[model samples]
Target chain A: MAVSVLPQMKQAPEMNPVERLMAATAADMARVNDLILDRARSHVDMVPELARYLIDSGGKRLRPMLTVAAAILFGRGQGHAVNFAAAVEFMHNATLLHDDVVDESDMRRGKPAARMVWGNKASILVGDFLLGQAFMMMVETGDIEALGVLSAASAVMAEGEVFQLAKTGDLETSAADYAEVIRAKTAVLFEAACAVGAMSGGADAAGRKALALYGLELGNAFQLVDDALDYGGQSGTLGKNVGDDLREGKMTLPVILALEAASDSERAIIASALGKPDATDLEVHQVVAIFNRYDTLRRTLDKARDHAKAAIAALDSLPDSEMKTILADVVQHSVSRAS
Target chain B: MAVSVLPQMKQAPEMNPVERLMAATAADMARVNDLILDRARSHVDMVPELARYLIDSGGKRLRPMLTVAAAILFGRGQGHAVNFAAAVEFMHNATLLHDDVVDESDMRRGKPAARMVWGNKASILVGDFLLGQAFMMMVETGDIEALGVLSAASAVMAEGEVFQLAKTGDLETSAADYAEVIRAKTAVLFEAACAVGAMSGGADAAGRKALALYGLELGNAFQLVDDALDYGGQSGTLGKNVGDDLREGKMTLPVILALEAASDSERAIIASALGKPDATDLEVHQVVAIFNRYDTLRRTLDKARDHAKAAIAALDSLPDSEMKTILADVVQHSVSRAS
Candidate 1:
């Protein structure tokens, strides 16, 4: 009999791609978690409280995972990967705190956003607190070159947010411009995280560059799928409702693609709803129809697949290892899971 | 007006304390200024645009001035001090941006606050950008020890801010707590700025420690005067009305001292106005009278003077030089000018 087919499949030896990596890296991830919790403590009550509130939430900790995984694949050095992994998580969480405030989001990780609970001032200040701590952690390693990689990424990430802000709802945003935004905002940190993690693990320059590229492509694919999801994905997958990016005036990839191919009347329909904070579900439905007509969502997924392929391809030159395959599958699955 | 006494006094050779030091370090300060303006340029238009807006405002540039002065006092190293000086200014400005967002300040240097102009989101993100730049600059120097100094100071500064936020309007906040808050929030940056500058200039360990102590005392004196000025200084001195600290519920030295000596009725009056955002000027006047009754303003200023003297005395071990003497006077003037 069709005896709980879904539960049976879940119990199969082959687990979900992400869950597999989670298991493979579980010990190191646990250590990273410990490092995160330890570093978050502070004399100021609000500092630790707010930091842990966000850090302990349902975040998958993918960036830190990538950092730790990359370090393990190289397998060298005095185990600075733990600190670097924690720092990467802190940077990612810090950005989320600021992003929620910037986007005026009400939720994060399917829970009330930190800004919603603590207010914008606390969120911003806490974000700065996290960043300061991240730098301190990085400095404690006494690895100047690796610190340069991360700091450079931090600057670029801020530039990206500003660039996105400038282009928000500007309907004139191009694919090239959209690529730059996601690259800076999303991929650069990923690139730096993996690169620095590898550096700390004593990876050679070539190996470091390969991991950096792998992370960059994975991040691009990940964010491209994220933008696509806002137009047409499961209702609750994004922590916010569908079309959240459009409502926030963000010029995501799908919107840019659909805008490029739309006729004047269709363009008016999309532009009318874009960047309107009060955009209704009906308006979102209408935008999705336009996206459907243009096949922008499918095309966005296709683009994501391309990046995922490139991310996997980056590992071709490296010696094959169990961790390397998991890293490649993780990159591919980062996109597929959004389907 | 018989002899136009004001003009005659203005024409005297003696310059304003800050101005005299500015002139003494004009070349180095100019180099720092150039570096600041140059590094502040960014591809993200909002970054450079917003950074320049605040950087060009008529700040006294006191922090960077101190940084360069400390560097020049030692007079060595093909001048990493310029970068450190710029980094110091960036750190100070970064704090100012976040502080305005936290304080909801509407004005800075007689201009609308960055948050007021660009909104809190821009101010916060831009502040992060500046800090990222600050760290990048510090890292570029490849001096891990100094980076450690600045990073440690940054963490303490954020912690101090959180501590102050926690203590806001709490009548139980103590004199020791207030000192800790000020030392962390204000004095630590000053300490780090001078220490790093001294290090960049090739100062010995003893010399570095001396500059650090000197800067810490000077910063304590500077903030003490700033707090005292909030209660009793001239118009426009704080870029806001007198007793702002009271309206904001800040437990400044004057308020703490008054709380200790206050009669029940007087304490009730202060409790009513403290931390009340809508506190009336009349209420502020009442608090000031109580402060006057206890000589708290004078006592606060006296505390500032003592710290300022200690700051100068810390430099006594250093060899005599024009820059050294100017630095000593600078500390004294930091307090006397408030009087």
Candidate 2:
């Protein structure tokens, strides 16, 4: 088949909120990236290799960008934001590496997981290495308050994961349980990242609290959208297989909502594929159809929009700036991904 | 079978070096134990369940004991020693949990490993929870320097594990490589534990360095004896199967020495079992015969003795006290375990 080319007028690409935030925080993020690679170096070649592979892979680096942006919003960091931002990213990556092993996941950020390339043992050890490095960086900053924030968040994140693991595949998992899981596993880090960044930039108590709330709400929106995308979006857009959450037996919000509204037979159809790792595409579609009947995806996205609105509202008390506008826009864009 | 009872005369039980250290540090250790249990508590039942199972299992809390002993030797510490000691134990337990997962181990401290009871996913998350709690405890103490010591040690320990994993099953692994592995994986934590304890206890630079060196050499001796006992000890004595090191393909000093001295046929016999997960008892016996022919176990124990001596010698410049004497005796006893 021959393809025909048509002449088109040139236009400048419009930057998304995340892209705008990235441009705004480019200098600090560059430093964060440099610090990440530098601190990731190890004499044990595999440590650096595995770490670099994951670090260089296409993560948006949004968490660290938030750290930098929050710091810029307060406008007083004496180069400490770079260290905090890098440490946050490392903590995030460490979690990702361990999460893959726990979930026995094959792909991450559109590439084969570190576990696949280096085996589960290496993945576990390197994840540990990165976590250690994260703490070490925090210690170097000699900001014990910030260290405490991150450490407490770390503990809560692990608890969230354990709680999520315990609730996996349980049909009775509630929206409340899902909220707790997302809060612990995902939003807590976001809260810590922004809180610490604000602290680094010498924010007042109110400013710090505002950024923390903003981050927490934004994180909720981020994860809610992600869960919705697992069923509503294409695999290409999500960088993972569609219905993976179902295959993994995760009682995500959509599934939880569908179960609550499902008929007995409809529930059975969804349950047939809920925790079955080998569930076929047809089985997933069956489950998705049930979800559609209940309008769970739209409901989940609606919940995400609520969180995004709250996230934007959090910045109302802070002084208005370009970064602030972009941050609010980022929250809106995050929830829009599914739609 | 009938058992016979014999009349026994009453006698005072002599305390071993470790027992003496434990007794001397009992007050501080009580607080440490309390802290450990308190921190290990999580709302997630499995987190506490798995963590408690591992924590309550019968392993001599030697690492934390060293932390307390080092602090007492300096004659100072305003309750900070308890926190440090608990943190050290948590770090050790975290490493053990992850190690069991990475090694696919079934037994630990004569009990089924945590992974066996709760599965690898729970083990990994619980391990992370413990590590996070450890840092939180350190942060609570407001001692950034001590935190730095443990954090750096944690990184080095992870690197050591990665390096050891890379060297597994390699017959050409040398004595130097084995030493590097032990120092990084085992000795560094010991060094950090003692060093941090001394710092918390207000020790001078000289005193801190002395404790660090003492701990490092003791750790080296501890690991060497452990490796040797894998070949020479009864399963009951070691709390694990004999020949476990060989079965796991660990390039310990004994294996390095045996390979160095083995002939072509002998090397083949050893190779057949090295890294073989299901290596039979007969295969282990054949390999042990080669080790015996080379006196590798005795030589390995001899190396342990050398390290024990150096550990004792590291305390020479310190002011003599009951704790110091017990610390020296503890090193001797650690190396004497294989014999």
Candidate 3:
């Protein structure tokens, strides 16, 4: 008798690093999200309405997840991590709202920006409201050291934005300046997030420092990948139009490197598109062609990979754990987004 | 012998209450100013440049003086008051920068606004920087209770501004709504400044509550007078043009009162100029005439006087001191500006 043919065993696809981290920290993230939504409420209709629009918009919530993951890595149950995570998210969203207004961005998170739906005045006020709420949340935690870390980070972030604004469209921007800008505006917050999470998680000084370093390096890699993606990635993936950084006169590393290597004629083409609000698609493509010709995008991505490696190296001293492994892999996934 | 004619002794001019408060808090205020200037410094040149412009532009520093004076009133010498005072000033200036952008006013403190010189984008970013620094200073103090007070006040102030924006040019805005708006936007910061100062100054729970109540009423009176002065006071003294509130469609007390009393035609005249950016001097005058006919300006000032009295009454339980007297008189001085 012929044996019944057995159904072929199907293989389950492996989860990406971010997805794995999310699943591992899902319980803590739910509490963090609850705190975030609760704190975002206001008596004023516009405050919450505008805030909800931004908060509900689909963001990966990666920063807060890092906070949770770092806490779990230290074997501490969620204590003040929930509050710290929520505050970190609020600060991040606050900056995003202000940045959109500053950049005159048309879209955010695959949706029309809050400023587009509400006016710029509403965007500014609500951003201020969110920032105020962020500090209030931190104050509620009664963790003075953590508060200091986050507050200092907030100041440095603003300084970074101001410095970046000052250097916009300037061809003379150096790699050093770009490094400083990214460190101040982007990496510091990440460092603060991880450091504070570790503090709340009962990590000792060494552990906190390691997490901070990991966060800083990861943030650097994340921003570099973002800069590369602005030129090399698709618009659908970016949630923003391709070439936006170039159109906004932002001197991202890709543009800076290209400007350094291009001929005078090629530099002129890039300049015409740089900071020109009305820059046509053709002009943007011409500039991108120059970037590709010099392999600046690839060079930028390579620099990102270096930071990603550094980020993983920061965790080497920690005892092996699933959370630690996930955190290291997450850095790799962040850099790999450009591919 | 001819009697020697003696020059008549000239009586010294009486110092206004504000002047008296300034004198009493001079030493502490000097420290506060130093702290303000120091914290305002940033590696980003534009940050300090814009911050200094606003800080040095000669605001009376009333809010910070209240803080120092409150601390001194409770005989706390000057521990964290200096930092709190500096932070209060920064918050005020931050709001002013943002308010100017929201109002699109060309002048501030009788000079071109920082936004005019630096652009709205700079004003926004610098305001953010100052706000971040404000929190940083508070965090440095390590007084979580004080920080909580200021941060909660910050959230309320933002809510107030958002509420005010929502009601802009809405004729149906009631007097109660106006009260809520002023309290949230203006009075809450004053209340917080005094309460925090008292806390830092070693005030017990009862003493802190008294100072807070005094501040809330004083703030109410202060804002009411400001609303009246926008119509009744001169541009030179107000540091802002007359009829600005009306032109911007701010539903201040006078406008709200006038709207309630107006006939259809009179309301029509006011409506034509309300929120009209290009509203001519003639139109503003016509609206003012209606305000005059309705006695709305006087009525508004009368309400301010009531609140001023209430403010002084709140201090009745506190022991008499020179600072207390100065604080009481300052409330009167603030209201008298409308007259």
Q: What is the DockQ of each candidate?
A: 0.63, 0.74, 0.70
Model 2 chain A is weakest, by summed lDDT over 10 consecutive residues, at A1-10
Residue-level error in angstroms, candidate 1, position A119: 2.1
True contacts kept of each: 0.63, 0.81, 0.71
Per-residue error (Å), model 1, residue B118? 1.5
| lDDT of candidate 2 over B1-339, digit per residue (tens) | 001110121222498888877777877888889989899998888988899999999878999989988887887566588899999999999999999999999999888999999999989998999999999999999999999999999989999999999999999998999999999999999999999888988899999999999999999999998888888756897678988988999999877898998889999999999999999999999998888889988998899999899999999999777778789989988887777
For model 3 the TM-score comes to 0.96
Q: After superposing candidate 2 on the true structure, give the runs of residues whose Cα lies further than 4 Å from its correct spot.
A: A1-13, B1-13
Sliding window of 10 residues with minimal summed lDDT for model 1 chain B: B2-11
lDDT string, candidate 2, A213-322, tens digits: 99999999999999999987578976799889999999889999999999999999998898899999999999999989999999999999999999999999987776
Which candidate's DockQ is highest? 2
Cα deviation of B122, candidate 3, in Å: 1.0
Residue-by-residue lDDT tens digits, candidate 1, A11-72? 33577778866776677888889988988888888888899999989888888888877887
Residue B84's lDDT within candidate 2 is 92
Q: Which ten residues in a row have the lowest lDDT in candidate 3 chain A?
A: A1-10
lDDT digits (tens) for residues A46-74 of candidate 3: 88899989999989999998888788778
The alpha-carbon root-mean-square deviation between model 2 and the true structure, to one decimal in Å, is 6.8
Give the Å shift of residue A262 in candidate 2. Answer: 1.4
